[model samples]
Target: MSSSSLQLPVIQNWSCHNCGGCCREHLIEITEEEKRRIDKQGWTAADGIATERPIIQKIGKGRYRLSHQNDGACVFLDDSGLCRIHAKFGEPAKPLACRVYPYAYHPTGEKSLAVSLRFSCPSVVQNLGSAVTDQRIELQKLGNQIVAGKKRDHSAPLIHRNSVHGPQQVNWPDFHRFLKAFDVAFADTSVDFVVRLMRVLSWLELVEQSQFQTIKGDKLNEFLELVTNASVKAQPDNDLPLHRPGRLAKVMFRLLTAQHARHDTEADVRSGLSMRLNLLSAALKYTTGFGTVPVLHGSQSAATAFEDSANTSPEQHRARFAELEGEFNCRTAGIDELFTRYFRVKIQGIHFCGPANFNTTLVEGFHGLALMYPIVLWLARLRAVRNNRSTVSLVDVQTALATADHNFAYSPALGLKSALQRVSLLAKMKQLTSLIGWYSR
Candidate 1:
């Protein structure tokens, strides 16, 4: 099937600036076909390709990937921050994985696909360049290629199947009805973003209390409207409650935020006893949440002072981190717009729940998504503190966002059952709402 018929996000702008960051960050695996094709390229020193090692390394039995230079960049990356393969051969000559980065394709249905942008790409995060709609031709071709010959017999994704909560089993059609209502609420600019989220959370609680088996088709729409109205009455306009997260929840959140911020680039070979000890020490620091900020590796970060805070006096850590709290306001209309676009795109693309998120219920997936607000805010604060500023610039927020989204739904650490449960627990304890209100201030 042609990918033109596939679902695409209506609100997004992205164009690669050729930062060469991906080439240095990701370990690209190639299929056997890609291997043979690359071999046929017959790269040599004469072609400006490195020959110190085999261009392709065997990662596992019959699994192969492009090798890296001593400087930890893809072997095809030239000194000018360009691909030697593309320069020598062409874009088609590159491996499939290499060609399909920053943009991900997911099978939303038997015959439908959804395109999701990775904020890990600075360009995507900044919403730079052209509208994604303008690139439909290229994206369509790419999506079809990605799912070539794959079966199109997918069952619709579930809403709350077998969950340890109320109204667990919901039909996909009814669940999608809930999605549309939530998306509308999120897109509503009448309330603050946090307030809109809280309102949705309000109605969602009622939806869970009611039996959804009796709700389908137009009944589900009416059910949603009823709950939404009741929630509006309950929450009222612009009235959101706030409280501090519990110590335990805060500790767990800090650890998760650390995992979100940290990255393992191609250059990162942190293994062996040293790596274990480093992680242990980092975990200890994250658990306490009292020291200076942890270093988010591989971001080429400009926030160095915070990273080396331990070397400073205890008084300095206390003073600097405290300064990060009150007085260093980071929230701005532009920042809110960035986050709104991000959430809307994820929702519109159907990339926030179900199979797109480890089979998490809509509420659970949104709990994780809501956590991004405070996480980004915290990282932005850290960035400002490190630069000896009391304000967060757009650059600070953009970098922090890229850092946080790197792990949002992609990190194995965040995907474990325990991690998923932690997010759910935060929502259960109302810490999710509290964190949003606290950090937004």
Candidate 2:
């Protein structure tokens, strides 16, 4: 029940560098009370707040969003990339969402919360800040507010496909055990990311297959050990295969990638379609065997087809794998730290992997915050691939993080299932690895 038990990484400190990225990148929604609060601040054209059209605009019937300036920046954003509200009144004057940039909260269980970073902010990607542990008091206050009066939904089933055992019911402690196994599997530096992913996937598969009733304390531990061993043994001779995608897969990949092409205005969507179409065509040509078709159809067809196009020799493959390991090592390090803290925060606050995932639990209200992680990673991978760079840059990662988080956080039109499915496909395609390879090239 103690927040410390969640093993959350310490939050030392974070001061916004005032890149104004979040202001430009996000559509901020406010409650009715916030609207009245902002109105009370009394803005006129002379006060530097837009008055011709109020800074706040009604999004639909009853919903409202902070309006953007003519240039698409937040109305509160001034010429120097500073928030007018922050400049005038201080940080507290900003809406909760604006104030909480980079830090996200999700339900873990009965009485806990999970804290994750947006990664969309360049500051987060650069690993700028004091250790999160330092921010405990502040974060705890926020967590307490979010989880106030929320009861544990013990009847909510685990996300695994199979039923978990024990008619007595599994508690948060039991769930933490499973999460511990997951974290350890991810932390295995000896294995490549794909191998680690494969290991985790395999373990999840087993968890799905076994009836919960059949799994007891020691049996669960044994199952984890067995799967972990299998994952280690199944490590690919080279890094996992980056196949020239199938036709359907190529189309899907391009469609997905096209979503990342930046559009400055609504008009840009139409004008930019041709450029995006060309990019998609080129990407598909390379990824759908057109680039390697000659070799595949040529004299040494079978041999060439089976050959690793990424590396020509065993030494070369090892070298490439080493490079990949380094790339993943750096990229995932911050992410792992962020997620561990995230899960722990949620677990301690009792916020993750349950009714928060679905609408079964009452009192919490439906907030699809759980899907943020996968979406952020997916977009970050896309940005890496689009740039054709090898390593994922902190800035681009932050951009993707911001993009996905912005879209998912506010868009009521999008459903949770759609978001989750998209993430599932990217994971299945090993999009992260592919993006790393694509960017590296």
Candidate 3:
């Protein structure tokens, strides 16, 4: 790929701190060639590494994955959080996936690739080590390997919007403009993050409703401007509707929690179901007005009568806000920085939507992908609340990411209906701003 063709955001410096989080957290899927390479390494118990069950295990009928130790650490991971392979041979012998810690690549166009990072790493969240831009040469080499001899057909249809340009024809710069606007929308401080998110969703809904082919320079700009304006204005009042949790929301929450429940060891697995159940109960209770409501629902009509009569001062509410914000600072920072970068990077590369939104066209796919950011953010926040942590953990972020990515990658069942369902909910809840607040907190 020519340097000019590489349109990804310049990397700031980043080097893995060897937290061994990924090693333990991920079920490493390896290609057949990788398996052979590891076999040729001549690893043994005498290498000072445990090799009781071998390092590799068969996952499905034909697929193979690196196995974890009985303790749930990567079989190649040592007590010092070092990789046995790197220790035994060298870093070059590590799997491509292992070598590409934090960095992820997706085909941007037929001839281009976009880079994304996993912020679940503490180092990544803190922006530690060298700038990402400094790693350009290495990232390019990896990109070459991934895209080499691979023919990417960019003629796929876009996801939610009715754009006629098809995936390959959509100009990347235009996509970047949309993304920049999105970032700005989230950065707006006048409204709550939830309200900001709702505005973006509302705009997306409009885009999806309109025919993309008919949308040109001024029309597009006008629409975006209108959406931003609406988002800023559509703040929820004190009497905002707080309805019961829908069945779909409950099911999605359960599904998401179940995905998070998987672990490499028995102990992790044992607690997984219980944790998921508890989270589900919490979600239903909070969203459905269950906990705040009386068993005799009708008798509680006058229960909140004091809500209008109470004389709590604005100073008191501000103090409470300050307290919650302080409590959630660390959690909010980690999530916000990670996600903000993640969204901008993907948007710049036009990877979030378009072809990456399954094998689809650019416009609709972009809508679907756009919706995912808020959904994942929402789910991660829920996870944080469930774990009693102020911030979303790298593990939870990774799980949410893997879950959403896996669905888009493999599930043919996710169609326009699913895409629009998410868009509607996000727009209604103004979830983008909520995500920002979560990160800010």
Best by lDDT: 1
Alpha-carbon runs more than 4 Å astray in model 3: 1-4, 10-13, 59-62, 155-177, 187-195, 217-226, 229-339, 349-351, 354-441
- Model 3 residue 334 lDDT score: 48
Task: Give the clashing pairs for model 1.
Answer: none
Candidate 3 worst ten-residue window by lDDT? 293-302
Q: How would you encode candidate 3's per-residue C-alpha lDDT over 1-441 as one tens digit per residue? A: 433145556533468766676676556778788899998987777776666676788878767888767666677888888898898789878888888766767664556677766544455545568877777788888777667666676432343433343223334444545666776776664544444455666666565555545565567677678877775566542123323434554344334322322222322443678756755564454344222211110101011211211112232221111122233333344454555565555555445554554544444454455555544554444444544456656545544454344343224445445544554454345443343333333
Stretches > 4 Å off in candidate 2: 1-7, 10-14, 148-157, 162-170, 216-218, 236-244, 259-441
Residue 147 accuracy (lDDT) in model 3:
70
TM-score of 2: 0.66
Best model per TM-score: 1
Q: Which TM-score value belongs to model 1? A: 0.89
Tens-digit lDDT track for model 1 on 1-441? 555356667778988787787787778999988999989888888877778888999989889988888767888988878998888788978888878788877665556677888777788877888999888889888887888866653655555433445536555466568768977888887767777777877776676556666678899898888888887788777756668667887877787787887766555652456655766787887787666554546353212212333223344333243455563554567776788788887776766776777767776787788888888887777766666667777777777887777677877788899889888888778777777777776
What's the TM-score of each model vs. the native? 0.89, 0.66, 0.65
Task: Kindly indicate the candidate among 1 and 2 with the higher lDDT.
Answer: 1
Better candidate number, 1 or 2, judged by TM-score:
1
